[model samples]
Target: MQHLLLVAATILTSDPVPEDEDVVAGWPGFVIFIGLILAVAVLGYFLTKQLKRTEANRKAGVFGPVDDEEPRDPEEPRS
Candidate 1:
């Protein structure tokens, strides 16, 4: 257990430091992230609207009345 703990500690503490240029490039990097968030929000809004319409239609039975058709073999006698 001591050996495993030492290996885990070393791995946890070791991290690469970012360079000066990487640290300074903030807004440009964030622009793409912000754009992705907006796109996802727009898509979610449209999907919600479509689902609401479908649910309303389902409640109203807009597709038409349900048929009472039954499946039967060709050789079976009809009532």
Candidate 2:
């Protein structure tokens, strides 16, 4: 138990040494980050445009006639 305690104290007192100081996210990483941002922006813009067009088409009754009837309860029998 005395030898184990001594070994633990030595390990706890040692300083950590870094292997490399030069490793970093350089120009390639920055370029890829910018690319991902642009891709998400473009996709969001297109999605909004498509949704607006679909809403306009639905209002124009392109798919079918719009129902003007009141919503019926599921418990009620169909007339």
- The most accurate candidate by TM-score is 2
Candidate 2 C-alpha lDDT tens digits along 27-79: 99999999999999999999999999998898789977654467777898865
Give the range where candidate 2 is weakest over 10 consecutive residues by summed lDDT.
63-72
What is every candidate's alpha-carbon RMSD to the true fold?
11.1, 6.6
lDDT of each: 0.82, 0.86
Residues 1-79 of candidate 1: C-alpha lDDT, one tens digit per residue: 9999999999888977878776764788799889999999999999999999987886677966433465567797655
Q: Give the best candidate by lDDT.
A: 2
Q: Which run of 10 residues does model 1 get worst, by summed lDDT? A: 63-72
After superposition, candidate 2 runs with Cα above 4 Å error: 1-20, 67-79
lDDT for model 1, please: 0.82
